[model samples]
Target: MRAIVVSEPGGPEVLEWREVPEPRPTRGEVLIEVTAAGVNRADLMQRQGLYPPPPGVSEIPGLECSGVVAEVGEDVEGFAPGDEVCALLAGGGYAERVAVPWEQVLPAPSGVTLAEAAGLPEVVCTVWSNVFMAGRLRRGETLLVHGGASGIGTCAIQMAKAFGSRVVVTAGTPEKIAYCLELGADEAINHREEDFAEKVTADVILDIMGAKYLGRNVSALNTGGRLVVIGLQGGLRGELDLGALMARRGSIISTGLRNRPVADKGVIVRGVLENVWPLVAAGAVLPIVHEVVPMADAARAHRILESGDHIGKVLLAR
Candidate 1:
């Protein structure tokens, strides 16, 4: 088996494809022959030595993947060998084979290909967990998402709209803003040119920039708003005005999926399969892939994701 190995922590050049021992399924796990892996910002962070995989997890960097099941471990009953599936993984999606717990695995949606399905898990699980489950974005209320053209942002826009929520997004480019609008975002703001804090008030805010947008996010919140911060692309430290948040009756939540326990991830995965899967199958939402690079050429995929120019998911296809 071959997987993308980090020679050392640095740039995209650090990612190398090399032969490695094949993984086998363990108790309650499933072994998958990887078809494609979704490239995410977290993978880049891992390559730069910022975020390492959880204990006892693979070193390879990938958060989601789609493939055929090669084998099933003891107690894995919902899946069988040869079943087509996609999984939300903590790590190791960059390899040709990965063993993961069955609870995080989901049957490929009826209308999407295995390659496309690879892009679904991470974005869907993240959006459903943060924007809906944590932020409590309800129908008729506006949901603001930073990085509106990103893989998670694209998925968030469509999923929120499908669930009857009004979606508002902030993107750096006009092209990205237009793309978000086409995906059903009711409002699109160019963060480069406009201050979103003055323009819109939202019931829920899904923010990626941590310290950079903290003040503005609180300012943009509507009464009793939930502000969910899922990524820290911006600087870590930020001055929080608890007075403003209290005045607006707003709350801030910080969450991440990678370090969560298996049972917690399973709960989010089940929610996605039950709720978001139907939207994908019905064409109300889709995995918006920007490009699919070869598995062996994962370095190129990392470059694409780190560029911040590509809209939607970038996949490394085997």
Candidate 2:
């Protein structure tokens, strides 16, 4: 099997395509013939030596993929060879084949293409767990999402709206903001030109910029607001006004999917499959794919994700 491997930390150029042994399914796992994999910020961070795979996991960088099952291991049931599925991988997705836990795999929604389904797992699990489960965004509440044109951002915007929440978003430019609005954001602000804290009212904030937006996020929140920081695209350190948080009775939460216990991710995967898969199959929620590059061009896919110009998910097709 051909896989993308990084021998040393660097840039996208560090990704090397080479032949590697095919992975076999272990107990409760399934071997998949990879069809496509989603490119994520975590992959770039791993390439740059900022993030490492969890202990006992594959060192490959990809985090989500869609494919057909090749074989099922002992204790794995309800899935068989030739089943069309997409999975949230902890690691090792940038290959022609991978072994994924059965708990992390879900049947691909009808009407979704294999390449597009590759883009679903990470964003879906992240948004549902953080925004709805953790952040407690509720109907009629105002929700703000940073990086509105991003894969997670787009998914968050749609799901929040679909659940009757008023969604607002911030993006780098007017074009990106417009794209966010097109994807169901009720309000879209150009972070480059506008002070979102002063212009918009938010009951909950789904932030990707972390330190860069911390102060403004605190200022923008309504009373009892929940602020969930999921990424650190900007610098990771910044000043926070504890006074503002206390006055508003706001709460701050942060989490990352990678490096978490497999049991925890498995629970999230099962919850998402039960709660959100119906929305996907019904065409109410969809994976937004910006580009699809061949697996051998994994370096190009990484470049596109790191460029910050893509409006949605970038996929590497096997």
- Top-scoring candidate (TM-score): 1
Q: Report lDDT (CA) for all predictions.
A: 0.94, 0.90
Q: For candidate 2, lDDT tens digit of each residue in 204-248?
A: 899988998899999999999999999998779989999999999
Worst 10-residue lDDT window, candidate 2 = 257-266
Off by over 4 Å in 1: none
* Pairs that collide, model 1: none
| C-alpha TM-scores of all predictions | 0.99, 0.98
Count clashing residue pairs per candidate. Answer: 0, 0
Model 2 residue runs over 4 Å out of place are none
Model 1 worst lDDT run, 10 consecutive residues? 300-309
